[model samples]
Target: MKSVNQIAVAVAVVGISVSSGFVAAQTKAPAVKSSTATQAKSSTMLKATMADVLKASQASDWRSLNPENTLYLEMDKGRVVIELAPEFAPKNVANIKALVKEGYFDGLAMIRSHDNYVAQWGDASEKREFKTAAKKVEGEFTIKYQKDTEFTRLPDADGYAPQVGHANSFAAARDPKTQTTWLTHCYGAIGVARGNETDSGNGSSLYAVTGHAPRNLDRNITVVGRVMYGIELLSSLPRGTGALGFYEKAEERTPIKTVRLAADVPEAERSKLEVFRTNTTSFKALVEAQRNRGGDWYKFAANHIELCNVPIPVRVVK
Candidate 1:
């Protein structure tokens, strides 16, 4: 049986042999060389090598996961990095921006966590009509594909779709039947809170994944972004037993002291971070090296990696 760490967490990768030596956390990382376009286009997908990947990953295959699309939920535990789906759901993203700007999530509570389902957080008030009107924003599934969203489809069999891969640093699956792409809710994944019809969230509520993959929630809720660095702060929280896993009383709830955008924070307090870009040779090489792990620790290599199981590593550079 897989242990809790294996069962509960999913992470990303970087170029070549770095997988075994990779460090992912809210702390610091040694300098990382970015990927370049020259290496990225040298050969077609199948012919690429680990060195080719690292060389391409030199300067071009790196992009700052945009701050405007980012949210930093500061809690007593730590920071949760959420990337918003602004293109897919503009209204929902805008509402979330407003709520963040207004400090709506500050002092609110994380009220629900259903194991094997989702760990949710938001205003737990019983005032349904009032809260409904405020957060009941519309949902938009027609997302304009951004130039930054360069997806590299995976070749393995997946329960969710014909092909599974990464785009914008999130686990993604594309339906050949419909050509639709959406974020897969892997562990530590973040999503907007909403009701049955969609467009029910005012961005006042949110959730983070804590258990098994819940692919059913993919297009149902507006997945703003995901916990890029500090997912442990949420997933390790004690589970609740009240309705929808809500703590029985206010006293048991975890308080969010503040939810601020990195852009809003002072430059000194911001997280100095970079994500190895998707579809680049370095990232491809990084994933491939781990996919087989020809390194010292393994007597044999798997030569296979699950879509959700792979981690896009994050580091704080000095």
Candidate 2:
């Protein structure tokens, strides 16, 4: 009789052979029966893979991006789609929306592209003017943690905050002791650039994170939103040569054709996309699948996932 360890090895070997079609001589082993039967009868049933979880998700598991809260940054190459987080930075988002409607960023330039850091754009000139009245929004680095907030906590350790989770589809951190919650500086996170004063950022200068999660920036800067799609457009730009990745020569700055709110654009011109709702049962299953990769290719599961490693799925509305 084979030991338990030996049985597991035999099962793994059989699974690989069956998946790789090494037993083609067995009349192409029944596709469904061979795979499902073996796994189901095993003492330890394999967890569903990420692909399997996503495939089993229902239509209700996803939510459409609200056009009123979406922004499109148009450049020569393509448009970068951004989703605003009103729940976190309401005043900043409101000011940004007003600026977009007033055509404040119609001809501004992207003045900075730092390699593995950030891609920032705004009025680089000192004589820049706002077309509309820009409000002085106080720095909204963190908000009062409300119990009713829709937060889906993750079962993982984070070096930055005591507890990490997803709030309104945005990566976030919460401290129950202080009763405060703040957005994390995950990749693609958009923050308003400020000067010496905390309230200096008036929805004019904005930067998107292109590198790893700089969690230290949380609670230090006002993060307004995140780039939902077309991050490649900004990430692929040439890094500037001057200090802090600013373009040394004025001509090197990339021209921004326009920045418009999706709601302001014509219906046919708007981009249609949907994001997976993080508060759904399917999302929990998806998270579990990622924590422990269970597939024929994986010999051992890590049984762990980081806050930044979690991928929020987005798909075009067909």
On lDDT, the candidate that comes out on top is 2
What lDDT tens digits, residue by residue, belong to model 2 across residues 215-283?
889999999888877787787789999999998888998899999999889999987766678888888
TM-score of 2: 0.84
TM-score of each: 0.76, 0.84
Candidate 2 least-lDDT 10 residues:
9-18
In angstroms, how far off is 282's CA in candidate 1?
0.6
Model 1, runs deviating above 4 Å: 1-59, 126-134, 141-149
lDDT of each: 0.64, 0.78
Q: How close is candidate 1 to the true structure, as a TM-score?
A: 0.76
